[model samples]
Structure formats: structure tokens, C-alpha cells
Target: MTEHTESYYAASANEYAPFPALTESIHCDVCVVGGGFTGLSSALHLAEQGYDVVVLESARVGFGASGRNGGQLVNSYSRDIDVIESSYGADAAKMLGSMMFEGGEIIRERISRYRIDCDYREGGLFVALNHRQMSTLEEQKANWERYGNSQLTLLDEEAIGREVASERYVGALLDRSGGHIHPLNLAIGEAQAIKLNGGRIFEQSPVVKIEHGSPAIVKTAHGQVTARYVLIAGNAYLGDKLEPKLAKRSMPCGTQIVATAPLPADVAKKLIPANYCVEDCNYLLDYYRLTADNRLLYGGGVVYGARDPDDVERLIVPKMLKTFPQLEGVKVDYRWTGNFLLTMSRMPQFGRLENNIYYMQGYSGHGVTCTHLAGRLIAEALRGDAERFDAFARLPHYPFPGGRNLRIPFTAMGAAYYSLRDRLGV
Candidate 1:
């Protein structure tokens, strides 16, 4: 068994193929940096197209946020729909919404076709913790309908209670298409698929620098890869040295989660009778759902200027108790924190830094399904199709106003404002 941080998923990761470290210069059709979901997915898609591909990971596969997320495979871009509409207008918003709807389907298809055992479940709920939130959900439902997404069903407080244990929510918008899965398992499975397709994945092979041109060269500690193109899918874990320009565009926000000891099956049923994933509409939202083993995996709290896991349980456990006081007596078995990137616009940043070098990151906690779609689009772009990739490439993204020295302060202030809004219920 591999040594891993104490995450529930880590405790259960399936045994997977071991990838060798890149030890010598190599050549390929594409050199993909970051072996998380996006890189692995791109590698698999590109390899299936018969392109020679090499994936480099700084640590073991899925060691980044890919392995540590809350695992909700949600729909909708990380930004609010209104933001998308106001910025891109109705047509572009409609297009983006349709793309996200299809993104969910892409995840389902991949799971079925690959037979991945990631504990996937459909039926997710977005709850409104108060009347203000309920009204917001109504507006969202109207907007989604305008975009021709009629599958969203509005549920009143009574219905919400039936689906979730918390009386905190006044109503909810149930999108059957949205769901959750074992994210780490999905990442590992995708890497396996890439290998089975004859692509190469080099674990612990961190790309220290890239020489970009027609045939890009990615240099690692022990080896280098020369390829026709490159893809940077490092997301939040793209350490400062690899791509400083990309790193400056987003701030790493630390989020924490805790899973309780398994509740009796009946008790778990009362909490989420339908076994649906639930997230409230708060700026710093509280998301919780039951695991397959009947544990309440609660995720909440944001820590600025911190990466230590020691403070995670203290920050999140209270929020969890507030939602489910019933779990007060239950033992908290697993607690961990993961860093995710948050862009100013909350939209994913995707485009090529150079003509032949492509990069995708800044999903803002909405990467579960979106990353998979991004992988496919990346593969398509590598294979001479750039239409879909161009749509996101054109989405505006601004770097954090202050440079490194002040970026954290700026983000902390922004987070404080959002936290106040969440508290004021505005």
C-alpha cells in the first residue's frame, strides 16, 4: 500500500499500475504536465487517436486536488450563471450551459464505457438555506429554463426535508443530471486507461521547465520529453516554478473536509434518504453527503494563508455539527484539507501560452465534470480541432491584482467580504 495522507478516499484507493519515473530523454506527439484528471484524460483521448503521449506527475498520480476534492460531479460553471450571462451575453451563456449539460453526460459515458468503480451516484441537490436563497433558486431555475434546461425541478421545504435531514434549507433545485463520485479512483482509472491505450505515464516525474516551440521540450529532474505539443493540467498543484504566469492568475485557497464514522443505515437514510449530494447557496458554502459506507462526509470552511492540515478539523467540524447535530457523538474518522485555485472570474482559464503549448486550470472547485470535458477538448485541439477550446480560450481572465507579495492579502480581503455576505445572508 502506498503511503498517503489520511483522506477517506486514500484509505480506499484501488491498487493500480505503477508508472516508472522518466529517466532519459524521450519523444512523443504531446507532452502533458500534471497526471491528475485533465492530463490523464487528455492522454487517454490523444492516445486513442494514435498520438504518442507522455504524462508527467510531480508526485504519485492523483496526489493533488484531484485526489482530495469533495468529489461532487456538479453541473454549472464555477461562476454564477448571471455572471456568465452578463459577461458573455445570452447566446454565449446558452452555449456554455449546453456544454456543461453535455459535460455531465461525458462523465457518465466514461464511467460506463471504462467500467470504473468510483462509487458514482446520480441525483444531486442544490439547497437554499433561507428565503433569500429560495428566491435565488427560483431565478436560477428561470434562467436555466431559458437556456432550455427543463430537467431542473424546484422543491419546497417539505420536499427538501425529505431529501436531506437539515431543516436549514427552505427549498432546493434538484438537478438529476448532477451527481458525485470517488474522484481519486476516477483519476487512477483514467491513468490506467491511458496506459492500456499505449500512452506513457511517468510518476514522480516533475516537469521543471518547458522549452516551447514547434516541437516542445519538457525537462524534468531525471529526464526530458520532446513532443509536438504540450498540455498543462496541473490546476491548483501547478507549483510556482513550473508556470509562473499561469500561477499568478489564481490564488490557492485551502478547503477542508471531515467524514464521520458510519452511521447506522437507517440513520444515514434519514439524513439523505435518496443518497443525493447536497450543497447550500452560500458564498462560503457547506456541502455534505453520505458516503457509500454510510458516513457523513461534510466539507466546509476556507482557510486563507494556511496549508497545514492540523487546523482543518477545528475549522470544519463546527460547521458540520451545525448541520447535523445528530452526529455529535459519532467519531470523526477522517479529516483533511486540499488546496484549490480560485480565479477572479471563477471561470476556468484555458488557452495556449504558446502556439503549440496548451494549458487548462482554475476550475474554482467545479472541476470534477468540467475537467473531463476539458480533457476531451484538449485532445480535440491537439488533433486539429479548436472550436470548443476557443470558446473558453476567449473567456476573459485577469491575474490577481497584486503580485506574489500582496496576492494573499488581496484574496484574504475578498474572502472576508464573501464570508460576511454569507453570514448576512445577502
Candidate 2:
């Protein structure tokens, strides 16, 4: 049995320097909770603005979903564009689209400027498994074009086959601007940059309580932080006590991934020749791509409750085989699962609780790019600019009804509905 969590990225984490635990009372211009992408990104931007920032992580840096995601730097919000346009009006939808486009650019620039070694790759294909999916892609393409996104290319089956290895997809949308990167390294690099800019980060120091109001006080087990602003960027893994109201706005869903042993160069090339990340347009999607070392990392399936790493592989490896029968005999070298936050509307939740306590979460599965954008917007809001951030904040969100006691049941009902729809290809 693999001793590690079986996450391919975790097995290959770069040498990250240990951060001191939060053991004493501290003060800062901003105090951030959760050291994943959003928190670290917020810290980096805040520190760059010459603010004294402090970040507190319950576990080690990148210990949550940031380290274990499929690493697809996809654009767009979790909610479908049509839903956004219909619900929030054309003006708000346009702002959301522009923000996502800029998000991709922000990730690219950070990777370049910080020299992060995260196997960053541009170019991604959003494939459609059926004619209905093809129609959806066409609609999506039209939507993007209407919003002035001319870089998106609609690809037929033959064209998609040339771009991807499998002939399973009927069509695809090639987003030249979106791509993938090693997520953990990116998070770590951002933390490093924050520290270099005179910010402090504490790992294994989970915030247990937040005393809301001006100059909020966040208490960890052994320490406390008083700051003019507090940012809750913890997303799914956020414990209940820190911000119970914010936590109730979304449910925690688990996503699983597995990586195959390195394949021969020729074999890997045949599987995914272009090295672009590919995700199908399914309600429960299957996303996979070749690693820098030629291993096939495939991610799919969902669990209502957290399970052991070993169980994660057992459940997902068969899904991988279904996608690539050529990998029938290849052994899965790593397997892991991470929790993701999902809102009732499937849109991210961003806004301040009391004007000074800003929080962002519930990106669903589109966090790689969304979190970076959120960080910048949150920073801008801190600097007294809320125009862009308000666009997302204005999108209404409903708290999960039934509270914590019945949250899982409601989520199960919702998931079952989506699962049935996915099966019926509706």
C-alpha cells in the first residue's frame, strides 16, 4: 500500500521551507484564513500593496485542495454562461467573462515573474461526448464570441481527434488562452512571494474563531491575530467554527484522482500528443492529461463523504480504464481525493460579511483560475475599488437549507438529480 496520500502532486512536492506555527498574538493590516490558493494569493497581493499581511493555515501550505486538484486552469465560472447571462443580465455576464479572461493572464504572468516550476502549459480542449454536448459547445462558442472572445475555436470530431488522443468526443472548444499548471507549486511560490514581500505565513495553525467587527481578531489554538481586515479564503475545507454562516452557503463535495505509472514516450505521445488538458462536457466530468514525467493523471467521480486514499483509487481507476482501454494493464501509482465547495447556484460566493471581513469560496471545480482572480479583486476592494468585485458579489447565493443536520441529504438529492440527467444526456 502506498504510504503517501497517493496524490501524484503530493508525491512530487518541491522542497518547501517550513513555516513557523502561529504561537503568539500578532497584528497586521490584513489577516487571512486558510493558506491555499485564495488565502496565499490574497496575502501576496495585499503584501505587494505594502500591507502587513498574515496568513494562517490549518495544515501545511497546499495541504488542502490546492495541492491535489486536477490542475486544469480553466476559465469561466462554475455556473453555465447562459445561466449567468439570464440571471444577472448582459452587463454583469460581460463583466464576469472579462474577469475570467484576465484571470488566465494573471496566472500566466505570476508563473513567469516568480519563475514557478509547475509544468505550466497553455491551450486546453473542452470536449463534447455527444451531439447534445456539441450543441452546448456551439452555444458556448456563440456566447464567447458575442462577448468578444474570438480566440475560442469550435472543433469537429476529426479536428478534436487530431488535438486529443481519444476518438470518444464528437466535438470540442479549443480555448487557446486557458491551460494547466502544477497547482501546489504555484501556491507555494505565491506564499514565498508573499513572504519575500514582508508578509508572515503560519502553517498547521488553523483558525478556530473569528471575533468579527473592525480590526477583527482571529484566534488559532496557540495564537491570535488582530487586523484591520480579515479574509476567509478557506473554501471547502473551512471548518464550521471559524465562519459558520459562510460555511453553510456551500456543501463539501469530494473529487478523486489517480496517476498511472510513467508510460513509454511513444505510448504517452499516442495518448495525448499535444500535452493539452482535456475535459469532457459532462455533468460529472472526466478530466485527464499527461504529466510532465509521462504519467497519465486521470480525475473523475465524486464522493458524498470523505474516504481513505486507497478507496479513492479503487473507485476512480475503473473510470480511467473506461476512458482509455489501452491503459487496461497499467497500474495506478497514486490516488487521492480532495474536498471542493459547491454553492446552490454553482457560482462562487464573494463579498464582505460586515464590510471589513471579506470572504470568498464555493468555486465548485473552477478554482485554479477563479481563485487568482478573486484574490486580485479582493485586494482591489481593500484598496477601495469594488466595481469588479461587486459584479460577482451581486450574483445572489442561497444558504443551504436544513442547516448542517440536513445539508448532506439535500446535497444528495441534488447530486442524484444531476447524475440522472448526466446519464440521460439531458
Candidate 3:
């Protein structure tokens, strides 16, 4: 059985009963694959709407990026609003802007309605590394404001230091609507809610083949799900061969994170005075936040080929200490890595296969909140309301250049150029 990685979130996640693997064939109104945020959220929404839902996961729930991410609920898509407007025109941008914050809202509503204890916090900060980046943030603040985000504040150098005891950042953008959470607990809680709503979930049931028809048959190792509809929510960790076409549109990249031993209350409070999650405005950015237990959870470091590094701590600690020099000898409690799907355009790809098979993937690294929005949209589409979902689907997506053999090297080259621009403050 595939298990969740040994990380801080896994160690601290809420306890839940193990879902039995699929051992018999079943039929339902909806057959959802992938047990992470998108699949679970889709199941929860469909179950609430009186649909017979069955979820199949290759591993345990939250075994993928949903559980191992930085835990920040950063709003907005991977490609900024400006890119959306420029690429797809103003009409598409206006539509997307309206729904940018809905994902985070869905998360908040679920936590409250289900009483899920995921250590929910209420703020996030985008720190600027230099004057050029601050200028970009000023524009970002304006763009978000035009989109009905009223909880934004741009902090100057003095305010930036006050918000995060870091001298590396010259300024910061604070978004009250963005926050952090114990992501794995959120997933597990939603899974429990799915069961309560009469939906069935089967873990360790990796899909072998999906036979598309009037009622699709999703064959797993031990069983099959015959359903009228199928929603493919698997992102990076989707190792199955059900969709070679969709897999070609995205490449998985690895990111690592480390958690320090719980710090003294006073020291923790001093590090981030307001307890806001923080991420820099760099091409290769660093994000960190204080856990509910006062430990510093820091994450950054990219592996282009989706290859896990040998020493996660060695790769991450120096980055953390660079942002905060006082932590010279802090013991790293836990470290792990996970992969997220990336698209060439850096925008999410949402579309349908045949008539009833739907798929959502390629949120890049900005999926924590986007996945929640996707679940709602998918549910809406299933209920004959595909207007909003279609808007996202209509956006153009291209396969990575040079195909799978050379896509990694090609992407790394593009990233290197941007990283240089970030370092040069261009």
C-alpha cells in the first residue's frame, strides 16, 4: 500500500479510519479518480447534490501534493491576471477574475460547516526581493483590487520588516483573503464528510484501464466502477496510463520542504509578528510560515525533472537561514518532497473527454486554492451548468516543446532565463 510521506503535516494530521481498498465491482452516478483535494472535493460536492459518488485512489487520501504542500492558501492562478487578459482577451479575464477567490472561499466554508480542525489561519504575504519586484507587486495589488479583492495592503520596507522579521525583503503585499491550513487534515475531513454523505471511497485501488461508454467502466486492480460519469482529478502523482493524451500536456516537477523543531513561543511570535504565511516575489521563490505548534515550516527548491533530492534538509535549510539568520543551529524536525503538474502556459487545463469524462489538471504550483475552485466548477458542469467551467476550458493549452524526452531540459532552460531576471531585479 502506498503511504503518505513522513513529513510534518502527516505527523500532525488528524486521525481517520483507513478506507478499505476496492475488492468488488460497483456502480455509481459518478466515478472519481485521485483521492487528493480535487477528487475529494468533487466527491463532497456531488454527494451533497444527491449523486451516487465513488472515489478511487491509487494510494491513501492526501498521499500526494495536497498533503505535502507548503499549506498556504494563496489565491489567484499560476499565470497572473495580466497574462490572462493578454492571452485570452478582456472578456475571458473578467470572467476568470470574478472566480479567482472562490476557491479559498470554498475551503473556508467546508472547514466551518464540517468543523474540520486543520489549524486554519487568516493571512498571507507576498514579499518583494528588490525595488523592481516591489514595483511589480504594486501593479499586482492594483490588478487584484480591480477584481473585487478589498482585503489587500501593500507594506513598505519598514512594514515588511515588521510583518516578517526578514531583511531580505524590501516590501510585501498582504492579502487577508489568503491564508494557511493543515492541508492533509482538510482532505481527511472532507473524505469523512464524503462518507457521511453516502459516498464510497476506495484507497490503494490504482486504476488499470478506463473503458469509455454510455456508462464508463473504471477498472482497478481488485475491482471496477461502472458509472455514468468520470472525473479525472489526478495531477502530478497520476501514474496510471488511462490518459496518454492528457499526460503529454503536462510535466511533473519536484519541490521540497522542511520543518524545524517547535520554537519558543516568544521567538516564534517575533519571527512573524502577525503570523502571516509569506512567499517571495521571485521566479524561484521561497515560502515559509509558522505552524500551529510554533515550528517554522519553510519550503523552496525546484527539481525540474520530478526527481527527489537525496538530502531534503541539506537542500532547504540554507534557504531558510538565508531569510532568517538567527536560526543557525535549529534542528530540522521533518523534510519531504512532492510533485505538482506544470503546463507550458502555467494555466490550469480543464476539458472533457468524449461526452461524460471530465479532467482538471496543470495548476502548476498555485493549486492549493485553485483545486477547490475546480471541484466546484466540475460539480456545476455535472449538473448541466457548464457555462463557467467552459470559460476555463476554452483557454488554449499546448504540449511542452520537444516532447517528453527533452521537455525537462527545455523547461529548465526557460526557467533559468527567468531566474536570472529575478536575481538581476529586471
Candidate 4:
């Protein structure tokens, strides 16, 4: 069986026995083509509602970005609802706005209902490095409040220090609903929940092709699954081979993270007194949080092309130190990189391939909360409640300009431009 990537998450994950690989053709009501958050969530939801579900995973569960991410439960899409309103319309924005906070609610619900011991903690902070970012946070506070989020509290520099213990931020925005978790453990817990609900999961069964029809046939090396519906949830790892059309509009980008050895209790408290997760407000932001074991887990920086960096430490250490210079001599216990699917629009891609083949991918960088939301929407649609799902399908997804060849350089150029603006505090 394939193993999870070497990261702090994998090292500290719960002991889960590997699910067996598919060995023969089988039939089900639905076939999920990935085992990360989206696949497991869709399968679990379908299984809960009495649908026979089969999940085929290319590697171990949570082995992809879902496992290696910074584990922040950030709300809203990469492009927030206000942007959707201006770009789409008021109606489209309202439909999306109603669901902006639902993903975090669903996460908390799963944790409580299933007794998932993923070390979930409530609260998240968006810190601002300059006056411009502080103004943005103020705007965000108003926007989020308009969307019915009353849990938000704007923190001035003094208040920010009470939460962040940092002198670098001008201010911060705290979202009580947002939180962090041990993501790999959450995936494993959800996988077990799927089994408890009678859903079949097959790891090490990478899909080879899909024969779309009334009943789609999903083929793997040793087995095949015939099902009424299919979902392509592989995101960045799906590659250009499995779905060439998807490869055109979306590109994979790598993000790196590093974890320090467990810090002393006093040091941990001084770093993040309230134990809330934090991410700076920037075009390309830096995010960090204290782990359950008192380790300071930090991540930032994006590699436009999906290639892993030669050294994850070299990419992330400087950023971590910038946030907490006191940790100059701290030992980094782990370092790893993972890919998040990026689209030209910086929004998720959701649409239909054929009559029965549906897909939900390209979450950009907001997969943590949005993936769970996608799973619920997919379930609702399959159960004949598609009004909610159609809201997302209505958005137009454009391919990156210059196609695959020039997309990376093009995106990198844009990122450089934004990075410069961030530096200038414009």
C-alpha cells in the first residue's frame, strides 16, 4: 500500500490500518475517485443517507494536500463572496454568502458527532503587517458581519498582542468559528466513519480511466467499479492524464510548511497565548499555529509550478523566523511540501463532465473548509436537491492565459507584481 508523505502530520497521525486494495470488479450507487477530504466526505454523506458508496484512493488516505496542509479551518472561498457579487451578481452572491460559514459548522458537527479526536481547537486570527492590511481587515470585519458572522471581533494592536504576542502586527481580525486540527487524523477518523456507515473504501487503487454512461465504469489496475455516479476529487494529484480537459484550466502549485520541536509551555504561551491559529493578510500569506503538543507549526510561500522545492526548510524557515524572531535557535522537527490546485480565477472548479460524471476540484488554497462544503453539496445534488449545487456550477471557469506552457511564468509574474505591492504597503 502507498504511504503518506513524510511530514509532522504523518508522524503524529493516529494508528490506522490500511484499507485493502480493490481486487475485482464491483458495483455501487456512487464511486468516489479520491480518499482525501472530498472523497471521504462525499462517500460518508452518501452512505449516511442509504446510498452504496465505493471510494478508490491512489495512495493512503489523507496522503495528498488534505494531509499536508497547515490545518487551518479558514472560511469563505479563495475569492470571497463580495468579489463574487461584483463579478457575478447579487443573487449569485447571496446564494454563496448563505453558505460561507457552513463549512466550519459542518467540521465541528463531524468532530462532535463522530467523536473524532483530531485535536480540534476553536478560534483563528488574521494578522495585519501594515496600515493597508489593517484597513483591509476592517473591511473584512464589516463584510463578514454583513454575512451574519457575529463572532468576529476587530483587535487593535494592543488587543492583537493579547492574542498573537507579536509586535509586528498593526492589528488583527479574530474569527471564533475558525479553528485548526490534526488534518490527517481527521481524514482517518472520517474514513472509519465511512466504514461504520457501510461504505467500501479501497486504498492503493489508483484509477486508470472512466467509461462514462448511465452507469460509469471506473477502472483501476486490479479492479473496476461500476456505479451510477462518479466524482473526480483528486485535485492537483489527478494529473493531466486522468482528465486532460481539467488540466487546461487549472495548474498545480506547491506550498511548504515546517514544524518546530515541542516548545516549553511558557514559550508556547508567550507565542500564542489564546492558542488561536494565525495567518497574516497578504496576497501570499504566512500562516502558523500551535500544535496540540505545544509545537509551533508554521507555513507560507507558494511555488507556482507543482514541483517540490529542493529544500522545504529553505523555503519556510525564513518566514517562520520573520514572524517569531525569538525562535532563531529553535530546532525544526519536520519540513514538507504539498501541492494545492490553482485556477486562473483563484476560485474552485465545479462542473459536470458527462450526464453522470460530476467533478469538484481546484479549491485554490481554501480546500480545508470548502472541500467539506463541496461534499455536502454533492450529496444534496445527488439526492435531488441541486439548487444549492447549481449556484456554484453557474460560475464560469476560464483557463489560464497562455495555456499550460506559459501559465506558470504568467502566474509567477502576477504573483511577483502582487508581492511587490504588498511590500510597498499599497
Which numbered prediction scores highest in lDDT against the true structure?
A: 3
* Candidates' C-alpha lDDT: 0.84, 0.85, 0.93, 0.92
Counting clashing residue pairs in each candidate, in order, gives: 0, 0, 0, 0
- Candidate 3 residues 1-426, lDDT tens each? 788899999999899989999999899999999999989989999999999999999999989999999999999999889989999999999999999999999999999999999999999999999999999899999999999999999999999989898799899899999999999999999999999999999999999999999899999888999999999988998752779888888999999999999999999999999899999999988999999999999999689878999999999999999999998999999999999999989999999987999999989999999999998999999999998899999988898899988999999998999999987889
What is candidate 1's lDDT per residue for 1-426, written digit by digit as tens? 233567998998988867888999999988999988788878888998899999999888888788988889788788867789899888777667768666677778878888988999888899998788899889988877776667899999999988888768789999888888888998888888888889999998878899878888999988999998999988877877777889878877788988888899999999899999999999888888888899889898676543665667788888887888877878889999887878888899999899998999988878887888888899888778888888889888887768767878888888789888877888
Runs in model 2 deviating more than 4 A are 1-6, 305-310
Worst 10 residues of 3 by lDDT: 237-246
| lDDT score, candidate 3 | 0.93
Encode model 4's per-residue lDDT on 294-371: one tens digit a residue.
999999989998888899998889888877899999999999998999988888888899978999999999999999
Candidate 3 to truth, TM? 0.99
Task: Please identify model 1 stretches exceeding 4 Å from their true place.
Answer: 1-3
Residue 293 alpha-carbon offset, candidate 3, angstroms: 0.8
Runs off by more than 4 Å, candidate 4 = none
Q: State in Å the error of residue 291, model 3.
A: 0.6
Preferred candidate (TM-score higher): 1 or 3: 3
Residue by residue across 1-426, what tens digits does model 2's lDDT show?
112244788778777778889899989999999888889888888899999999998888887888889999887888867888898898988788777577778888888888888999878889988899999999988877776667899999998888877768888999888788888888888889899999999988888889987889999889999999999988888967677888777878888988899999999998877888999888888899888899999998766544444587778888788778888899888878888888888899998888799999989888888889888999999999999989988988887778777877877787789878877888
Whichever of 1 and 3 has more lDDT, that candidate is 3
